[model samples]
Target chain A: MIVTVTPNAALDVTYTVDSLVPDAVHRARDVRRRAGGKGVNVARVLHALGADVRAVVTAGGATGAEFAADLGAAGLPADLVPIDGETRRTTTVLSAVDGSVTLLNEPGPELSAAEWALLAERVRRREPEVLVCSGSLPPGAPPDGYARLLAGRTSVLDTSGAALLPGLAGRPAVVKPNLEELREVTGLDDPIAAAAELRKAGAGAVVVSLGADGLLAVTAAGTWHATPSKVLTGNSTGAGDAVVAALALGLCRREPWPEILRRAVALSGAAVLGPLAGDVDLAHYHRELAAVRVRPEGES
Target chain B: MIVTVTPNAALDVTYTVDSLVPDAVHRARDVRRRAGGKGVNVARVLHALGADVRAVVTAGGATGAEFAADLGAAGLPADLVPIDGETRRTTTVLSAVDGSVTLLNEPGPELSAAEWALLAERVRRREPEVLVCSGSLPPGAPPDGYARLLAGRTSVLDTSGAALLPGLAGRPAVVKPNLEELREVTGLDDPIAAAAELRKAGAGAVVVSLGADGLLAVTAAGTWHATPSKVLTGNSTGAGDAVVAALALGLCRREPWPEILRRAVALSGAAVLGPLAGDVDLAHYHRELAAVRVRPEGES
Candidate 1:
């Protein structure tokens, strides 16, 4: 089974409004809520692909109870490690007037050292074939928390900021960072150079996401570029998680780099067309999978 | 114990942010949450004053569970009636830069006829010294829901719109409406004239809140006006609820018209000095109570 870990989980709530007037009251036309965190999203995508997946999350307080209840109601498998701090909620206000999204993310609850230790123990017991660690670390969690969780397993890491900086030292099988994250990590505007820097820093493979342009994959097998035949646009909130899910599944099946890149690009494209993160339109995914082009960097 | 009923209860969440920019991400520095509604706020204020008080509220789903937990944590007494729909949440975004509060209130969950009957039964069992039915009615609940609950139990009605219009016909011992609500109910811009119209509509007494101007009481005993010594400026979100609480207590003690207006004005003003709704600065309340001035309209 593919195992994913989310250190800072959230209940993501989306409210659709006719218009958003600053400093004025807004009555939402529609409201939707889901269990959210990068790793949780990744696991959700993998599960939707008919893969065996389990998610490990830290939960506490009333919000935590609600988060767990939401996951249970969705029939998602999770291993919850109790903590003392209450989980946070992230609210996204979608203004239909101009198609703008306003995000309000709470700083997640802080974790005690003992709580981190418990989380580490829980991950160890899972015995995952392809382990994936994603999302931001809770306050007070060590910057290298993901690195320690790696422990030389066949793992993928998808995070940014201090966690990503220190985690690069403990090389995972694959590292995925979007364009902005790459700039933050390497202080370079060039994506290729930043990917190379990450590769040199012990990452076995480096995959850099370039938003609408698609993704670049650099590995010992050789560098590859993959893109969908047509651009699909909706809410691209969880497109990156779709890519990570694809990569983890590919690792579990021991797929070739070219095939993996093609699937990742197609799935990520399909995710954008879907309503929420971690969900892909099966029809669009199949169509895009056939049209996705992946080849050596020099060929394209 | 004084009892309060809230047909539409809410989980009130406050987020303190550096500044609010429309359609942009806001990272909150601090967050606070509590149980809230007009009647809930009244009960909270009365409870804080060491008075025997119990709040009866409609609750459902995870958010409802959290609302009850918050009340329990605060050591407030409550009787929660179950419903099928989830309770709503009201968010207040406080911008530190300009001290502005942006309110976002969700239309509360709809109540089935059975749920409303169950709530009414729960309130009846409480057998309170003085009953208070406050706030807006949920969708699907009858506009005269508070009128039906009153049942001539020496109750006070604090609501607006259609709910207030029919509720006044129940002949509540007191009907507390702010200046705006009085105008909306009677279609009269004059506060005194609007209050007089309400009194003529079977209401025993009419109290109109005038915000910074103070409060006006139109009762069978005599017309009176009460004003605080100075205007306390801060968050006035719960000032009116405090006035309702004071009125309920005064009705229970059978206080005279002038003393009741004086205490209600002071307590309402003191509520503005507190950081949150349902809380008043005790020192401010005492000082303002002593300095409060009350006089007959024509005798002055």
Candidate 2:
């Protein structure tokens, strides 16, 4: 089983409004709330694809209860570590008029040293074949939070900034960072250079998600660039999580690097077609998979 | 004892940001949540002033639990009727850059017929000396929800549209509507004419809140206009609720019409000086009370 760890889980709320106007009052036409976080989304995608996956998350207060309930209702396997601080929420306001989206993210609750240890212990107890660590660390958490969970185990690390560099110490099997995150960490605009920097730092393989441009992979086997034939238009919030899910699945199944890259690109494109993050159209995924093109980095 | 009824209660959330720009993502600098509804505000004000007040509100799901916890923390006396539908939340985004405020209100959950009856039964069991009905009725709720609660009891009614006109049939001791609501319900531009129309519709007295201009009251005692001597600037979201609170207090104390009008205007102004609804600066209230001006309508 693949175990996904979400250090900072959130209750994602979506408010649909007629139009979004700054400095004005709006009455939401509809409100939808669900469990969300990078690792949670990754696990959701894996579960939807009928993969063996379990999510480990930190939960607290009323919002946490709601998040846990939603996860249970979705029939996603999860282990929740209780904490004192209330869980945070990420609100998305979708404007019906122009289909524009505005996001307001609350910095999640600070985890005490004891709380962090508890969460780490929970993940360790699971003893899964593959461990996927995703999302931001709450305030006061050790920067090497994901690295602490690695313990020389096979892992996929997806995070940014301070948390990103420290996790390299554990030498995760795959490190996935979006293009912007790669530039921020490596101070390199070129995807090839940035991916190389992460691989050198300790990553067995580095995958740089390039949004609609697709995925660029730098692995021990070889460097390859994968792209979907058609650009899909929809919410791109969970596209990266989908890519991480695909990569984890590929690693678990021992797929070749080229095949893994192709699946990652196809899954990422399909995620964009979903209205919310961590969701994808199965039919779209299959169609895109056949059309995905994977070639060596130097190829035209 | 004054019993304040909030048919549609909310978890009011405020998010403070550096600036508010449409179609852009924001990371909230601060977040504050509290129990809210027009009646809840009125009850809070009364409790703060050391008056005997109990808030009757409908609550359900996770949001309701949070709301109830907030009320308990605030030490406000309340009766929460349990329901299956989750409580709604009203989010206010405050921009630190320009002090511009934006509001997003979720339409609260619809009440089942059984739930509505239970709520009414709970209120009737309290046998309050003075009943105060405030805020909008939830979807599927009876239009005359406030009227049904009035069983020849001394009451103060503050609502709009269909709810406003129907409550008058129960002959509430006072009906308070802001200028905009007055026009919508009575279709009259002149506050004096509209106030009179409401009295004719069976309201014992009609008080029309005119924002910075203060209040216009038409009663069996006399016609009067009251205004604060000087304008106070702050958030005006809960100013009307403050006016209703003062009116309920005055009625409970058997105060004269002129004295009550003066207090209402002063309280309303004081509420504006507060950062949040149901909050008042005691110093500001005392100062404004002494400076409030009240006169017969003809003199004005």
Candidate 3:
């Protein structure tokens, strides 16, 4: 079973209005809420694909309760670690007219050292065949929190900045970073050199997401570039998580490296076609898979 | 004891940000929450003034649970009626640099027919000396809901539009309508004639609130105008609720028309000086009371 840990899980709320007028009163036409975080999105997508998945999350206070309740209502399994601090809520205002989305993200509640230890222990006990540690570290947590979770597991790490540096040393099976994140961590303008440098730091493989340009997969076996036939334009919030889910599934099923990259690219494209985070149409995923083009680049 | 009925209660959330740019991402510096609605605010202010008060509110689902928990945390007494619909949450984004507050209000949940009767039954059981029915009606509720609640009681009705028209026929002890609401309901530009017309429709008295200019109280006994020495402004969201609270107290105390108007005007100004809804500084109230000006505006 796939197990994911979202230490900074959130209750994501989206308010859809006719149009958003700044510095004025806005009455929302529709409001949608979901249990969210990077790892949570991965688990949700995996579950949508009919895979057995469990999400280990830290939740507290009223917002935390709402998050847990939302997960239950959606039929997503979660092992929640109760804390004293209230969980944060991320709000997105979507304009129904033009489809412009504005986000308001709150800094997550700080976790006590003891609470961090408790969360680490819970993730370890889950015994994931393919573990996914995702999202930023909450305040008061050490940067190595995700690194510790990746210790004796074949994990996919999706995080950036302070959290990514220490986590790279733990040798995760895959590290997914966007173009900007790759530049920030390695301080290198060249994407190929940055991925190679990240691999040298002990990441098993590096998947560099290039947005509309597709993905660059660097592994010890070989390097390959994969791209969809055409760009799909829509909400891109959960595209990375969908990619991670495909990679984890391929790793668990012992699929070929080239096939894994193809599936990941297809799933990422399919996720973009959907509206909400973690929402992907399986039919769209299969259709995109046939149109994906994968070519092996020169050996690393 | 003053009893307030907030048919549409809310979980009020405030986010303080450095600056809000239009259609761009904002990272909030602080977040605050409370249980709120017109009647709830009136009850809170009355409680802060050491008046015996009880608030009857409708709450449901996860948001409702949080609203009730917040009320309990604040030590505010409330009688909550459980319903199937989830209570709404109102968000206010306050700019730390300029003190600009942008409000986003959700249309409240639709109530079942049985839930409406339950709420009416609960309010009647409270045996309030001065019943206060305030705020908008939830979806699926009859416009005459407040009129039914004001039956066989000396009540202060504070609402607008369709709800206010039906409630005015119930002969509430006092009906408070701001300038805009008066114009919308009566379609009269003249405040004096509009207020007089409201009285003729079976209202015991009429209190016309002219924001910044102050209040005009017209009763069968006499007519009086009351105004604070200066227009104190910070957050004016709860100023009307404060006026309703003072009016309820005065009715219970059997105060004269001029005295009641004077206290209402002072409390309204003091509420504006405070930062949040229902959070009037008693010291500010006392100071404003001394400077309040009241004059007989010729008998009606």
Best by DockQ: 2
What's the CA error at residue A259 for candidate 3, in Å? 5.7
- What does candidate 3's lDDT look like per residue over A229-256, in tens digits? 8988766778899999998898888888
Docking class of 2: medium
In order, what lDDT does every prediction score? Answer: 0.86, 0.89, 0.87
- lDDT by residue for model 1 over B1-300, one digit each (tens)? 799999899998888888877667687889888899888899988987888999999889878988988889989889999899999987777777876666667788899999999998988898888999998899999877878888678989998887987887778999998877788778999877888889888789998888887888999988888888987776677889999999999999999988888889888988888788788887888888888889987766
After superposition, candidate 2 runs with Cα above 4 Å error: A179-233, A254-258, A292-300, B61-66, B127-129, B179-235, B254-261, B291-300
Model 3 residue B235 CA deviation (Å) reads: 3.8
Q: Looking at candidate 1, what is the lDDT of residue B106?
A: 79
Model 1 docking category: acceptable
Instruction: Quote the lDDT for A262 in model 2.
Output: 83
Model 1 residue A41 lDDT score: 87
Q: What value does the lDDT take at residue B264 in candidate 3? A: 92
Against the true structure, what is each candidate's TM-score? 0.81, 0.86, 0.81
